[model samples]
Target chain A: MDLIQKSLLQQVAGLHDVPEGAYNIRVNGQLDSRNTTANIDIVTKEDKPGIDIIIKPGTKNESVHIPVLLSKSGLQDMVYNDFYIGEDCDVTIVAGCGIHNCGVDTSKHDGIHTFYIGKNAKVKYIERHYGEGDGNGENIMNPETIVHLEEGASMEMETTQIKGIDSTVRKTGGDLKDNASLEIREKIMTHGKQYAKTDFVVDLNGKGCSANVVSRSVARDQSRQEFFSTINGNNECKGHSECDAIIMDSASVSASPKLTANNIDANLIHEAAIGKIAGEQLVKLMTLGLTEAEAEEQIINGFLK
Target chain B: MDLIQKSLLQQVAGLHDVPEGAYNIRVNGQLDSRNTTANIDIVTKEDKPGIDIIIKPGTKNESVHIPVLLSKSGLQDMVYNDFYIGEDCDVTIVAGCGIHNCGVDTSKHDGIHTFYIGKNAKVKYIERHYGEGDGNGENIMNPETIVHLEEGASMEMETTQIKGIDSTVRKTGGDLKDNASLEIREKIMTHGKQYAKTDFVVDLNGKGCSANVVSRSVARDQSRQEFFSTINGNNECKGHSECDAIIMDSASVSASPKLTANNIDANLIHEAAIGKIAGEQLVKLMTLGLTEAEAEEQIINGFLK
Candidate 1:
């Protein structure tokens, strides 16, 4: 069953026509299964199902963003197993999950998505996870993304988790070659009593390579969140990792980052910290006439920004 | 002239007790040149002369602290290079400098200190840089410390930089092997216009290794601070690095931590952030009858706590 799913996902992901420039995507209104692209293939049955496509741009001009949205019921409820972005293409993929089907209750739901970027490809991927109102059941999402950058390739990835229905676990891995660089910024904000875990790993296999990982989390009430990151520098590779967390009220947050360097000349650094907001900042905002909640929100937004 | 200074510096470093778990130190508090370490050999006479020595443990396990006063006048009102700690054992070294000698008119004065740690040894190094009154100087302190950790070694390093200085730069490096570990923590608070930079690099070459680095900085006024850290992982090494900075008003801060993993099985992570205090904290403190400065100070202290 797993083999069939993997093959199906690969087939769907191999259909993209990723161009060499910027790609812009937008998913504004509701989209039905009948509106599927001719070049994209989607399946809804068992084993590797859902929508899959290769994003190949036809233009060679400025950068663009290729947007993807789950608007309608068929697209929203389908099981998306695998997703991949091809090599040597500078592209931006924006994906957002909207809450249109409001009345639903279940215990467990799994949505797995996989991404693979080719060597020397500069890709900017932004994922926005949000749900409106309060839905029942454990809505589980497992997004596994793997990126491989050849020599001189660079990638800037951003993941924002805001207001969710159930729980989320995101895992990401990347490989960088000589002079390659990878930068990942993540911001997670929640006030619900749920669990969220985001784990990231990057390896700099070549000489003079670099990596930057930064995460900011704000939790309120009984919410719990964990962030784990690891960066490895092998044989003259230079790698760096940074992790930070903020807890509010009864929220529980944990962040752990590890860095390892094997070569005598290799340099590595890792940092992790957990704390609350400062007092002086709150006073400054209160003096400006804003209420307590308003001030906290402003500071949270500014820190993430 | 430069050659002489380099040799003198090298000689002093060599006085570190070879490769034992003992600390050998020699000091001359007076400038008369008559009171000096008997084993001390001077290799240079020019600016920053090179010195060498071999120190044997004086059969005492007492807590040792050496004060290197940079404000002292030499043949021509020059600052003296203070040397206090020696090598080959587990020791706690405390080095501090005050801002009484340098007048307020000058804007640039460089003070540099060199330190070397041997294999299979543990060292707890505490550096406190503080000033009194308002007659501050553009003091530039560059303390270069090099540590070589053989099988089963560790280090706990702490630094506090506060008041009466225009700028500070600190660079620390360590080479670890055979389950060696290094832990460093720095707390920095600044008032007035100043610039400070803290940099640390730890390279893991052994099969089982670990590293932890943490830094906290509070900047007021138009002061600026930068922190750069790198942790390298090799041969199944585990490492971690973390930095947190709090800003007020126009205070600016920049922190960048890099973690590189070269081994496929090595684990590493890093975290960093720069931001101002929050507002809700202040409102709560105001309700408790604390003034703005008092509340802010409470917040700053709370962050360090």
Candidate 2:
């Protein structure tokens, strides 16, 4: 891989060099490098432009990295990835995409990922999106994620969009069976004339199931953001969703969270808040010898951290 | 004052007995006790059912307490109080109302407070509302506050509604002149089928003027709450408004904050957020041996603190 691809990998997936264990690196719409371990298998899809990841039963302490980079301008990339986890397995999956467009044409990427987990399995998934360049073109990304958790299965997802993406539409959905659980944390930041929209829905379908979803974002300059979340409790379960955002300059933000409980014992709640930095907070930081701009930057960094 | 009135005073204004300095206590729609100091004068209004409080110029470190209580159900009371603060004075004002109705009819109180602060003066105002009873009667309160801050003047206002009020509507407005500033903090909590609404508007009409308004609230059971705030920066000034709320059970909350910056140097922002207790927060507390309910209580207490 080139230095630009290596830097993109570092920024999105925290890869310092050629990683150990199972890994796949894609650059400019083609696979650049691939590796597989004893407990993990990575196979390229024969009919489409993606890969299939299979984890053996009882697999533990293993991880797989699938990071993609687009260095060519005017490139439109679409990929489909599927993950199948065996029962009693515990593993981690890291997937992300980065775009560097320095031309007059727009560059776009759409990713669709689906996860099927067996009973009593546990998986931790992390995905990050980033774009950077000094160009007149735009960077756009649309990612859709679907999850199905079997009985006693659990999943934790952390997704982030760092910077430079001009537009994005992120959609995520999950279904939890008996004794299953799902947790998701999302973070995003938009600046300039950029726009971002996110939609999340979760269904608790069996007894003792639960789901928690939280999103934190910041919008600056003329950027705009909209967040929508829904939680449906179809059994004796628990669900919660929340969205928190900060607006600066002429930016705008809107949040709507809905909850539906079909059972008397199903507990569901949602909360959303959009606002600017607090005067007291800024004053307190300025009293510690920081300027107004510095204090604002510190506050935003801390909030998005 | 009687025992019931004294208890109500304690709950609303933290007055265990006759307060020091100037004070006026009203119970059952009549004056129960009155006192005045050399620097502060309290006189009953001849044209209305309220009092006029006048503070002398340079009246340093002086304070006044005006508390009202209603013990009889089926009563509707309205009062208008005006305050005149002389130039260069620094004072504190404590005002609150409490209702303890144990009958079959609703008890209500409507208070209108207007303040005319002189040039270069400073003031700190605190107000609290509370209601309690075991009967079928409802407690209702509607309080309105208007302030005119002169050049170089400043004021900080803190208002709170503790509990048991079945319905309430609170409105506050402020106007700031050159080099003047205003700050307001409000807190409210509603349970059962209670309803609460709050509206705030502040105009920064002069150079170097600023205003900040913030509200925190919690809704439980089937309660509902609505918060609306508008900040108009008409000159080279700064303004901000925010609302934060918690929703539980079948409760609902909505917040809308608007900002208008007419001048190029006018800086304005607003923020709002509503949700229930976080799952991770509860789990962290449960790890310390507390139950889920106890953890939620502790979190709510800390958030409101």
**lDDT of all predictions:** 0.57, 0.87
Tens-place lDDT digits, model 1, residues B1-305: 13322232223232222212322222212222222234232222256432322233331233333333334222112233333334345665555544333454433323344444444556676766654333543555555556666666677877776666567777778778878788888888876787888888888888787888899888788787777787766556777776777767556555656555444434666666545566789889988999988999999998875
Each candidate's DockQ: 0.04, 0.04
- Please provide, for model 1 over A126-149, each residue's C-alpha lDDT reduced to its tens digit, 9 standing for 90 to 100: 766654433543344455567677
Taking the tens digit of each residue's C-alpha lDDT, what string does model 2 give over B129-151? 99988859999999999999999
Q: What does candidate 2's lDDT look like per residue over A87-148, in tens digits?
A: 99999999999999888889999999999999999999999999998859999999999999
Best by TM-score: 2
TM-score of chain A of each: 0.76, 0.98
**C-alpha lDDT of candidate 1 relative to the true structure:** 0.57
Off by over 4 Å in 1: A1-305, B1-47, B50-60, B70-88, B101-104, B107-114, B133-137
Candidate 2: chain B TM-score equals: 0.98
After TM-score superposition, what is the CA distance of residue A168 in candidate 1 from its true location, in Å?
Answer: 29
